[model samples]
Target: MQTIETVVNVTSERQITVQLPPDIPTGEYDIVIVINESVKSEKLAGEKKIKTLKFSAYPVGLVADNFTFRREDLYDR
Candidate 1:
C-alpha cells in the first residue's frame, strides 16, 4: 500500500491529468480526488491583492544604519 498526494490544474472543463511516480509499479490502485473551488479562488484573490499592495518607507527612526546594536548586546554585560 502506498499514498501519493499532488496538485494538478484542470486544463479542460472536466478533465485533469495526473502523473504517477515511476517507483510505483504499473498495476491497479485505488484513486481518490477532492476539489475545493472556493479555496483555490480565495488563494488567487489573495495573491492579486498582495501584488497590488503599496510599498512605503519604514516607521520614523527605524531606517537603515540605525541598527548599531550587536547580537550579544541584548544581554547584561
Candidate 2:
C-alpha cells in the first residue's frame, strides 16, 4: 500500500482530476478520498460576507419583576 498527497482544483462541473506518478504502475486499486472542511470553509469565506450579530439584552416584563436568580434554585430539592 502507498499514499500520495496532492491538491487539485475542482472544475465547474464538480469534477476532480488527479495525475498519479509514473512510478505507480497502471493497475486496479482501492482509492480513498478525504476532503478537508477547513480548506473548503476558507474558500467560501472569500466568496461570501457573513453578517455579524449584535448581542442585546431581552426586553423587560418577560419574567416577574421580583424574580431573582440563585444557584440553589437549579437543583432538585
Candidate 3:
C-alpha cells in the first residue's frame, strides 16, 4: 500500500480538499483521515465533539477469577 502525506484545508461548507499525488496511478484506494487535536481552528468551534472508543482486549485475568461460580449457582433462586 502506498502512503501519501499531505495537509488539507476544510472549507466553510464542511468539506476537505485532498489532493492525491501525481505519481499515484489511477485506481480505487481506501482512504483514512485522521485529524490532529493540536491544530485548532475557528471552523471546528461550532462542531460538536465526538467521543470515540478504541478497540480493547477482554480481561482474561478478571474473567478467570470471576468465573468460579458453578453451573447450578446460575439457576438457583
Best by TM-score: 2
lDDT head-to-head 1 vs 2, winner: 2
TM-score of each: 0.46, 0.56, 0.45
List per-prediction Cα lDDT, in the order shown: 0.75, 0.85, 0.71
Per-residue lDDT over 1-77 for candidate 3, one digit per residue giving the tens place of the 0 to 100 score: 77777777779998987777798889787888888665554445547565668998876564555666678756766
lDDT of 2 by residue, 1-77 (tens): 88998887999998999999899999899999998888888888888887789999876663776666776765767
Q: Rank by lDDT, highest first.
A: 2, 1, 3
Q: Give the alpha carbon lDDT tens digit for every residue of 1-77 in model 1.
A: 66677777877687898888889888777877778687788888988764566789776863466565676755676
